[model samples]
Target chain A: MAEITLKSLAHSYSKNPAEPQDYAIREMNHVWHQGGAYALLGPSGCGKSTMLNIISGLLEPSNGEVLFDGKVVNSLPPEERNIAQVFQFPVIYDTMTVYDNLAFPLRNMKTPEARVHERVMEVADVLELTSQLKRKAKNLSADEKQKVSMGRGLVRDDVSAILFDEPLTVIDPQLKWKLRRKLKEIHHRFRITMVYVTHDQLEASTFADMIAVMYEGQVVQFGTPRELFETPNHTFVGYFIGSPGMNFLDVTVRDGKVFSGEAQLLVDNRVHDGIARATSDNVKLGIRPEFIEVHQEPVEDGMEVKVEHAQDLGTYSIVYASLGGISLKARVEEDQITPVDKAWLRFPSEKIGLYVDDYRVELPHE
Target chain B: MNKVYNNRAWWLILPMLLLVAFSAIIPLMTVVNYSVQDVFDAHTRFFTGTEWFVKMLNDPMLQGALLRQFAFSLTILAIEVPLGIGIALLMPKRGWQASVVLILVTMPLLIPWNVVGSIWQLFTRGDIGLMGWSLRELGYGYNITASPVDAWATIILMDVWHWTPLIALLCYSGLRSIPDAYYQAARIDRASKWSVFRYIQLPKLTNVLVIGVLLRFMHSFMIYAEPFVLTGGGPGSSTTFLSQSLTTMAIGQQDLGPSAAFSLIYFLIILLVTWVFYTAIMNMQKDDNKGA
Candidate 1:
């Protein structure tokens, strides 16, 4: 296994890219540590797949280098790079049996038949494809086919990394979880440097120890699931990580107070000082819906909001409220009283994130 | 829910039945009528039973032509299928070059059968044609009208030139339909170029190749125009295929009784051989352990 490093790597499909908009992957440097289970997470068309392809050596970056274990491997082709990739759709040789499909990569390397058989049996056992070994790969179900494809990657002992590009997309919902658990089990057992590319946050968070959140061709934040939820480094990360996302409101700092629209927002002096020294006028206050406390009765320093509606979602309820003409969502536990029509929302200072130009700003105190 | 048994719904198929009868059955019946009878005129006819059929089947000349037809069909198929696949492999996958190559490759298929024969006729003329004159100049005695071997070789080459494009186009479209991910996965698997073609491309092209082989077989089996135009069934009828022989007997000599019998035999041979080919290819596709 090898640590993959992207050093100032960038890519553009255009022959001559004049502006940053032309880039599919904007210039960035990132490192995936050796034997790390990492996920490149983003929405559709966010360049996560492009980054994965670059790391796998399927794509050559237009600028900068891709280093594997401190060696520049930009000139190497995918086959020479010793990497395996599972595509979005399962790609199996239709005529080959599951045994042959798993043995394909090993056979290509001219591995002896005895060892090939041993490896094939081992991988098939892990994928629970032992019974299917004699059957043609094309006859298997979609999830089984995906497992065979993954088994093809795992059979080769020399492979330094395995890149998955949304491999669970075609699987049935019930089997997706099983296959995901199978992948986790495999990762724990083998410890090959695995990079899973996915648009689903839950899949990424569950499968990856660290997720690199991509936004508009750039990796905005790389952190653990808890870290991303607690302190998102970028506004896009905050908005993308949690369900119903983080609530954002445009605010301005006047003297030592913060006001969103015409209504004054209660903020600690640390936030007020950070906003006061902000270089840009594009300032936003961000807070997760789960962190916001909703009260039916007005409490001290609580901002009054017009509760438009509340959705009772079994375990918890989401309060959709408007404060000073800005929409906000607050999550309330099922045991708590549901707020309706009008409610008071409290934003704890520790949970509040100040943003300037779509980037999180650190308050002076912490 | 109770099942509705509608007897009247069967009448809705009458139009298709009438169409099939008019298009196929009636014409076949006319041929059968002529085959079993000595029709002196439209009105005056004598029942011949299987006399014409026995005579036609036992004829030495007809037997020779049948054997020659099988050889020709098999030979052309063997040449065209692999050559077509190779051309498809070399073809550009996309861009303006792909369009240009496609149009160029399709040019031969668009020419009429007679026109293709005429083109080859002029092309292989011993005195003036490019190929014939070049062979002559290069000290090779290449006379299609004199030597049977030259005539047979020339006919095979002409057929290959005229029809390999159909197979190539079919295989090209089949190749294009395969997604790019397969290639990427193959690369990641460290598969050799030949391994990729053998495992990925050839298996995917099986469906189209089946169609291509069957079409080429049927077309080549009934081929009359091209060889007839170029060689005229000589070098002593060396290149005389079944269709040319049938045309000579039925139209030129006007042997109505025996020719009609031969026509039926010809139709059955094509039907039987095509059925065998189709069944064999389809059987190859089924799972080995599962007998169908």
Candidate 2:
């Protein structure tokens, strides 16, 4: 296994990129630790697959270097780099049996027949494909064919990494969890460095120890799931990670007080000072819906919000409210009594984040 | 679930049945009727059951022609299939060059079949043609009229020249349909060029190859124009194929009863061979084992 490093890497499909928007991957420096399960998470066309392709050596970055274990491999092809990649669709030799499909990579390397058989059997067992070993790959279900593709990667002992580009897209919803758990089990057992690229937040958070949330051809945040949930470094991350996503309210500074319109928000003095010192007029306050406390009566440090709707979602209810003419969502416990028309809302000091020009500002936590 | 009985669909199929009868069944029945009778004229005919079939089957000239037809069909198929696949592999994949090459390769296919025969007949003339003149200048006695070997060779060459492009076009489309992911995956697996062709490309092209083989077999079996024009069944009947021999019997000599029998036999032979070819190809796709 190898730790992959991208040093000032940038890619553009255009021959001469004159602007930042032309590049598929913006110039950045990042490293994946050896044998770590990491996910590159983003929406469609956000460059997650582009980054994965760069690391796999299937694509050469237009600018900088990709070093595997601290050796420059930008010129090397995927075969020389010893990387295995599973694509969005399952790619198997249609005429080959499941046993042969799993054995393909090792056989290509001229591994001895005895060891090829052993490794193929081992991987097939792990994938629960033992009974299908004699069956042709084309006749199998979509998910089974994908497992055989993954098995081709796992059967090779000399592979440095396995890259997956949304490999579970064709699988049924109920089977997706089973396949995901199988992947986690395989990672723990073999300790292979796997970089999974996907657009699903739950899949990324569950599959990887850390996620690199990408936005507009750049990785905006790289952190653990909890860290991303609690402190998103970029506003895009704040909006992209959570289920309902963090609520962002546009604010302005007037006389060292942060105001949404005419009413002042209860934030710490450091935020107010930061707003006062900020040069850009674009400022926003971000807070997760789960952290917002809903009180039936007006209390100190709480602002009265008009209740638009309350949705009871089995475990908890989401209260859609308007605070000073700005729409907000606050998650409340199911046991709590529903507020009629007006409810008092409070944003926790530790959960509130200040932003200037679409990036989170570093404010002292209370 | 209870089934709904709807017989109106039978009415919907009547037009197709009438079309098939006019197009296929009626003509075939007329041939069958001619095959079973000895006719002096349209008014005077005698029912001679199985006599014409027995006479046509026992004719040694017809038997020799049938053998030659099989040899020619198999020979052309063997040469064209692999050659077409190779040409497709070598062809440029994209850009202006691809379009130009595609146009050039498909040029021969668009020519009328009779025109192709006429062109080759003139082109292979030993006294005036460039190819024959050049070969004669090189001190080789390459005459299609005198040597049976030369006659057979020229006819096969003319057919190959005219028809290999169809196979190439089919294979080119098949090659283009393969996604880039398979090649990428093959590279990642460290597969050699030959292994990639054997495992990936060849297997994926099986459907197209079946089409190419069946079409070439049937077309080559019925081939008459090219060989008839180029060789004219020359060199003492060495290159006389089934269709030319049948035409000589039916039209040249006007022996209607035995010629009709021969025509039915020839039709059955093509149908039988085509069915065999299709079945063999489709059987290769079946899985060896079915599991629970």
Candidate 3:
């Protein structure tokens, strides 16, 4: 296994790119540590696949170096780099049996047939494909075909890493779960550096120890699932990660106090100072819906708002409310009294995030 | 529950039956009628009872033409399939060059069959043709009218030139339909170029190749216009194929009964061979399924 590093890597499909928008992947530096499970997560056209292709040596970057184990492998082809990639759709040799499909990479390396058999059997056993060894790959189901493609990678022992480009896309939802579990098992057993590229947050969170969330051809944040949820570095991350996402209200600083129109927000002194020091006019207050407290009765220090509606989601209810024309959502527990047409809302100081120019501003620690 | 039958639905198929009869069955029945009887005139006829079929089948001249027809069809198929695939492989994948090459490759196929024959005939004229004059200048006697080997070679080369483009176009379309992901996967697998073709490309091309092969086989088996215009079955009938022989018997010599019988045999041979090819390919797929 090897640590794969992208050093200021950038790529543009155009012959002469004149603007940052032309680049599929903007200049950035990132690393997948040796034997680490990482996911490159983003929305469609967000350069996640482009970054994966650059790492696999399938597409040469227009600029910067891809270093493997501290050695620059910028000029090496995918085969020479000893990297395996499973594409979005399953790609297997239609004429070959599953056994032969698994043995293909080994055979290409001129590995001995005896060892090839051993490796194929081992991978097949792990994938629960032992009974399908003799069957033609083309005759198998979609998920099985995907497994065979993954097996083609697992059969080779010399591969430094296995890259997956949404390899479970063609699979059914139930099979997607099983195959994901199987992949997790493989990563744990083989300890190979695996980088999965997907547009799904749950897939990334479940499959990767660390997720590099990309936005507009740039990696906006790289952190653990919990860290991304609790402390998103960019506004896009905050809006894109959690269900219903984080609620934000455009605010302005006046005398070291944050105001959403005419009413002043009662926030911590650190947030007040952070807003006072912010130079941009794009200052906003962000808070997760889950952390917002909603009470049917007005209390001291609580902001009164018009409750639009509440959606019962079994264990918890999401109350959609409006405060002086600004809309917000708050997740209230089922045991709590449901809010009526009006309710009191409170933004917990510890859970509140202050944003300036669409980026979270770190508040001074107490 | 009891099922009910609708007899009125039978009337719904009358139009299709009439269309089929007018387009196919009526014409085929005329040939069958002629084959089964010796028609001296429209009103006067005698029952032949397979007598003409026996005579036509035993005719040595017809037998020689039949053998030559199979040899020509098999030879041209063997040459065209591989050459077409090779051309497709060497073709540019995109850009203006790909369009230019496609236009150039399709030029021969666009020409009328008789026009192709006339073009080759002038192209190989001993007195003034480029190939024939060049061979004569080099002190080599390359006369299609005088030598059977030269005549056969010229006809085979002409057929290959005229038809290899169809196969190439089919194979090219087939190759284009395969996604880039297969190639990327093969590259990651470290597969050699030959292995890529053998495992990925050839398997994907099988469907198109089947269509190309069957079309070329049927077209070549019914060869008439080119050889008819160029050689007229000369050089002691060395390049005479079954269609030309049937044409000579039916239209030239006016042996309607025997020619009709020969036509039936010719039709059956093509149908039988095509069936065999189709079944062989389908059975191969069935075996793969059984293995699964």
Most DockQ-accurate candidate: 2
Q: What are the per-residue Cα lDDT tens digits for candidate 2 across B1-292?
A: 9998999978999999999999999999988999999999979999999999999999999999989999999999999999999999999999999999999999999988788878977887888988888889999998999999988998889888888999999999999999998998999998999988999989988999998998899899988888887788988899999999999999999998899999999999989988988898788777888774
Report residue B178 deviation for candidate 2 (angstroms).
Answer: 0.9
Candidate 1: segments with Cα more than 4 A from true spot: B290-292
lDDT per residue as tens, model 1, A1-366: 898889999999899999999999999999999899999999999899988888888889999999989999998999889999999999999999888999999888899999999999999899988888988887788888999999999998878899999999999888889999999999999999999999999999989999999998999999999989999988899889999899988888776788998888987888888888888989888999999989989988799999998888999999999988889999999899998799998899999999899999888875
Give lDDT tens digits, candidate 1, residues B77-179.
9999999999999999989999999999999999999999999999999888999999999999999999999999999999999999999999999999999
lDDT for residue A166 in candidate 3, whole number 0-100 = 94
lDDT of 2 by residue, A140-242 (tens): 9999999999999899977899999999999999999999999999999999999999999999999999999999999999999998999999889989988
**Candidate 3 Cα errors over 4 Å, as ranges:** A262-264, B1-7, B288-292
Alpha-carbon lDDT of model 3? 0.92
Q: Residue A354's C-alpha lDDT in candidate 3?
A: 87
The TM-score of predicted model 2 comes to 0.97
lDDT of each: 0.92, 0.91, 0.92
Per-chain TM-score of chain A in candidate 1 equals 0.99
